[model samples]
Target: MTATTTADTPTAPQGHPRRWLILGVICLAQLTVVLDNTVLNVAIPSLTEELDATTSDIQWMINAYSLVQSGLLLTAGSAADRYGRKKMLAAGLALFGIGSLVAVLAGSTSQLIAARAGMGIGGALLLTTTLAVAMQIFTPDEHPKAIGIWSAVNALGFATGPLIGGFMIDHFWWGAIFLINLPVVALGLVAVVSLVPETKNPQGDRPDLLGALLSTIGMAALVFAIISGPEHGWASGRVLMTAAVAVAVLALFAYWESRAPYPMLDLHFFRNRKFTGAVTGAVLIAFGMSGALYLLTQHLQFVLGYGALEAGLRTAPLALVVVALNFSGLSAKWLARLGMPGSIALGMVLMSGGLVSIASLTEHGYGGTLLGLLLIGAGAAIANPAMAHAIMSAIPREKAGVGAGINGTLAEFGNGLGVAVLGAVLTSRFAALVPVAATSLPAALAAADSAEERERVTDAFSSGLETSQLMGAAAVLLGGLLAAALLRRAERAGDGRPGDGPAAGPDSPVGVSG
Candidate 1:
């Protein structure tokens, strides 16, 4: 559990040239998976039309993928450690491409949903393996920059996804979106098979199967219950029951992982204040960003009269700026000096303030809102690298892969929960404001009162969207305060790093105690 300080030249592992080439392959695989999560959202309209889907069916398309992803990332980490990382990465890439093909040809919503699940499994495997492999391949000194690009490409993929999906939906069919993944997958498979080396946990411990199952079921139930509660009343018996079940199952999961010999998820990391603080802060920031993005896309499309492609292009300011700043390594030095707590607290404050300005989002056009989103984006970019340094530095070098795997799993779950819960709040608020919306509608439309009066009801439904955006701002503000509270000045932390004054290491002499 202790890290060795060394200055030896890093071995090439064959050669440095081969490792860099392989890193490209790993990045491509990561990009494809991350982008697919957000990309399909923009193309949902096209999928609905082509597949003759009801609204609920289209919801399942997204929820199913995310549910599977959120549920299994932790288990997938265990699987990667038990099985070989290189084999998993290669197999995952191939399987994902096959799943894409299945989706491309599917004629019904159910089939497409299953196909997306297949894609998620493949995605979970690839994501867990890629980060782990990258750490194993690169020298410690060069690891941050390499991981930064890897992280940036992941951010870039999500950031650029809507634009790509919009272009395909506008010019071609929904299938074209899945089709684009083929070339990348083909190249990635070839590169990975040729270049990546195999690694597994030499200990060969048994994976906690019961813990994995409970976690999967609990996450699925919780996410589904939250997302569907607005459509079905939150107070409804079915919704209440599902919530109860999710809580029970998750409790069982926590108990099992605690006692299991080879836990799918290691819970002891939270004993370290730096680890706990960083992760909690990450979840809050993600909540703010995810909710805001969901509301803003709709605002641009429905209210501001922008086409999907144009909407994506307009928001390029935030995403592109993130890309630029992340590449500059601007935040790393500051966070290394200020430590985890200070940097995260500052970022959350800026992000929260930014959300306030963005809440004043106008139907007429965007001017200041863009700047607000930019601030939020910059905050997120700074926080990403700082957290990585703090989290990894807490773990010894040998366990770097495990730490990153755990971190990534939590990050993804937070993303799904953020999107689901914030989206539910917005929907519930819009529905609550419907009476006022109906009053504002044309008298003739308002008077035509039946479930069958689709046109009038649909028109009245439109105004509630603006209310949703404002609510999104409130959610972001709340998340900011919560994230800020999670930060503590890490400069005062007693970790036994290079500059720490009187700090115990995370694993010894008196191990981590939050």
Candidate 2:
């Protein structure tokens, strides 16, 4: 079985008439997956009280979904390409709905974690297929605009997840959060079945079973190791062993893909600097965004002493700015003027600045953090669509599913690493400054016997957070520069102008290559 290039399949000259409607359905599916990623954060307290969940159980409940989703993304994407995007989408919806129902009915923390893992499977399929389906339905000329909307919806889900979850937990019950997914899943199924067209790689080869197994095990181990680092000591035997296994397995997976007859992921895609650069930007941005959100949520709840609902409400500005910029066409306009590399770099620069603002002004309260949130949101709006476009354009349409999967896998990897590494930094710094032996801020505060001790713990936590934010900002800033350099190098090699559309033939900046 030989590999087939995307050029083997001809693209439609025009997009589907119902493409916009289909996009809505696709966004709905995307929202469900993205929302689940963050929504559970607000529900942790409820679970602790309702289910008597231990610290380890709560951590697993949060990590299981991400671990499974990240691990299976490459396999799911490849499967969608081999089978059919519409079929995968429908199956994903059914599975996700079932998982949500199971979560709602779960009687114990173990059951909830298992349900989350199931949902992760569905999420992997939904995420890859939704983007792949969107690529199939839209013409290259309209990909940027379509991606802008798609990216905005992604931001919306992340931004609004806590708010929705907080509300559900406050008014109804913890189960309400999972229960809400049912209607969205049902509607998505209806729309997928009715409006979405079936698409797959016509020349796809036999299943890459070995490739899939290696990739899955490797990614799962990688995510597991990351999640464990902050909880277990980073250099502890368990974390070290897991990290080693992840590295060894992923390396083997990479080597196998290069030799496989029908590789699950094309190793050659990295040779395209634009694709690589876009992917780098995605990882760095996700790292910053995820780490910031994780810390900020704690900062709001613990340091500022806000209730869950109030904290969720306060974070609304981040999502609002992202949605506004993307929908107002300002993001598109910026993409046009700045080009792909320029846009990504500029967006990341703004994000770094936002993180810096938050780091420097922590003592000033919510008033100071608000501007940082808005800036971060604006940065994401400007960069995310361009990054998506660069990535999708570089892949042949035939492999769009796996392409989307690859994008997703790296972003998730970045997210996991951000939380783990930044969290570890915070923990280490806090420990160094605090006089208490408690492992966490909440624990330390509880252990504090006097007002002076409580004040000391709070100040230590705040200082640790500031240090973590500055570190994140520096990492993102450096990543932006490196991505810009890579994109510029690709242009100088005569790939084409950065501003050219994906339809600009083989000479285009992000043109698909055999």
Candidate 3:
């Protein structure tokens, strides 16, 4: 349970005095990266017309960044831990800026996809190192509040992306969306160089080259298969082959990490119930939220006949509530009263209830979905900080980078899987109910020859959406129950509070809570 002092470990018992300033810089960096996740969603239509992009090209453009970023996260984190977090963060910002420039200049779909992939590399480094830096800067007592703010910024980014993108696309050009990242990147770079201290594991072993390669390849293949499944049938040869490769390589990765002296990721982390529960809860929450958002955006645009800007604006309530709760410290208060397990369980149940309410929507308008959005926002605000604390506290300070990377990777995987799986479900249900032969709602609407047929198509789409919501709700509810059970068991076994695990020590940057 003890830790050795290293050059990177903060000597001050209260941790870094400039921790708040450093957190602002970190949150800025994180916002830029997270904004890219949804900003492009609003630009899809513009790009289709401007670049003459095909459906396949458009999908790749969207998938490239996430696929590459998710694949490289573990490797990037391990590198940061071995080398330096601040250095890695600087490199990420520089690369991301360059990628933005490339994207702005891109006139072809292929060029844009390549630019996005490059940004993905930068995003992987940024996302992993940002959290690692935060862990190094803050004491355990301050961890929840810091993480709450960080989580709030994350929600803010997702919410603001569409609104920003929509405005830019309307007022200027499609490239303006990418151009917006430049100022953030420039400021982040300056702040990081001046304020953030270097941190790395002094006793860390040589880089696990083979382990990194296997992990990157496995994760990339898995994401590719998931992305491909909805566009091409799941049973298609390409998806099947890629999925098989992913499974085989990931299995090898597990075996290698278990035996390697300096594994890129330590397989033993999964043995800790707190870590496992937090990770599981993260994936499930991501799955439900991402899937719901994906469907709701479409429903707003196609079914309810809202513009991209309008749809984006309508989704603001969720983000607003999350931000309000986090900044007001209400979420932390709930965490204190409920404990980690109870808070996480309550949050999941709220989210599940929200999904159920959305599923029960009878009126085809935004008013019907308002209550559900508020519930989801509250749930996310309460659950995310607890989950982050549980996962990070279980990890040694030296390995904080990779631990954050693992968390990011699984969450990204859950996001991609959610969209694909839910999209598939909606498509299937629509097909069964629609009078037309089209598999998608847009296609069905276009193919409908009569007014009655169009009505039928809309009805079918609504029914499909309801079904998907219910499915997501059920999965999240079950996951919450299981995660709560595991976390409670860990506590009963004398793990102490989330921040008081084996990793807490005199030299530990994170503090131990009583």
Candidate 4:
């Protein structure tokens, strides 16, 4: 539904190139947010070295962001539309910058966690608003190219996250990783303030605080339940209670949203088959890919004894293949060829196939399992762009922010859940055997400096990598088979236009070249 307040069409400012400037702003914002997700992971080891933080707490370093971001995304998106996208985006950047400063100066683990939560707020704001901003800036024809650019830049940022983090950790302390966000945010703030215009939802939907609260709580409950399940025994009382709370929260959210005058999340979007299917497919693909990725890192570092750079290089195939395929996809009949569901399903299958192939490598070493990782990487890279494009195309440009929020939030959730599920499996299986394995091999056990020894323990960790890989493979295969069977046909654009051209639309994101 279009909002009541009409947004003024963005006009090009003389000597100021509005399009290029907006592109720069969105690219920078996306890079900062997406990179934050993975870059911090590489520093976990280093951070623990510097600070006596526990692994469980360190996991929160990642989870806290996901939790806060995912919980707030729907509300943030709705707020951007209700208030103003540009204003909201700027507020987010400012908050992120503040949080980055906190992290840079953080003395304790709890302080760092709070800073991350602050950064999460800004990130959610930026991520939710960027799509809406892009929708406002570009025309229908130019939109595809812009979206491709945004996608490509996001690809580059996420692709380089590990390499950047690894390089920083090698030279600087862990804090430098976050300290680095400053210059980028500075550039974005300047550019956006000058170039981007304010956009408000003309639909004039009041910010439904109750609806927002319900959705936020519901999502938090569900995510917490999933994440906590593996830590606590799945059948344990805590797990059961969490699940029950999650169910209740979700039911409450749905009921409240359905009745609210202006809901934070538009539940009716699911009535559109394309929207529902695309979202469902999006979540599944992320789950499959994330689960596999979590496992792959273990195999690379633990089993193969790869250094940070080497481990990143091994997974380079995933990024490389995606660039090649995406470049060629611009020329090929990607949109006209497979349509939405077809493209999504095809991608899911390839990803799952590659993941499942890991089962083969379980018995073998570097030679046997390396191929599986490569395949999974390639499959994931190829499928992700298409899935993103499908989600963008399915929604009306007016509500792109909310739609994008849901899509973005789901992707993050899927990634987190994927790691948790597969990781829990690997951890559980490995832990059970660790006691047995430790007793059997005295060499594998830690020395007198027990905690320090464990922190510095790479050799034993590598031994457990095999178990993680097996679990990743199983998860991928299960997801693959499910996608292949469930996704029956391809989905075309809303207009069903023949885009032997790129599958992007009039309001897609920007890329390297705007």
The weakest ten consecutive residues by lDDT in model 1 span: 505-514
Question: Candidate 4, residues 220-285: lDDT per residue as tens digits?
Answer: 666566656655677988878877887898798889888777776777766655555556766766
Cα-based lDDT at residue 331, candidate 4: 12
Which residue pairs clash in candidate 2?
none
Off by over 4 Å in 3: 1-12, 48-59, 230-232, 362-364, 437-443, 496-514
Q: Candidate 2 on 37-110: residue-level lDDT in tens?
A: 87887776677668876445665686678767877787788888777788899999999999999999999998
Residue 33 error for model 3, in Å?
A: 0.7
Error of 1 at 205 (Å): 3.1
| Model 4 TM | 0.82
- What C-alpha lDDT values do all the predictions have? 0.65, 0.80, 0.80, 0.63
10 residues in a row with least lDDT, candidate 4: 505-514
- TM-scores for all candidates: the values are 0.84, 0.91, 0.91, 0.82
lDDT of 1 at 347: 62
lDDT of 3 by residue, 1-514 (tens): 2234533443443567778888999999999998888888777667766887644465567667877787778888888887878889999999999999999999889999999989989998999999988887787777788888988999998877888887887788999999999999999999988888787774555667787678768877876776666567789999999999999998998999899998877777787888888888988887887777777776776678777787788778888998999988899888989999998999889888888877786254566688888888888898888888888887876777887888788777667667666766786677679998864566677799999999999989888888988888887887688888889998888654333632343323322221
All models, RMSD in angstroms: 6.1, 4.5, 3.9, 5.9
- lDDT by residue (63-138, candidate 1, tens digit) is 6776676567666766766566777788789988999999888878899999988887888777788886776556
Off by over 4 Å in 1: 1-20, 52-56, 435-514
Cα lDDT for residue 348, candidate 2: 88
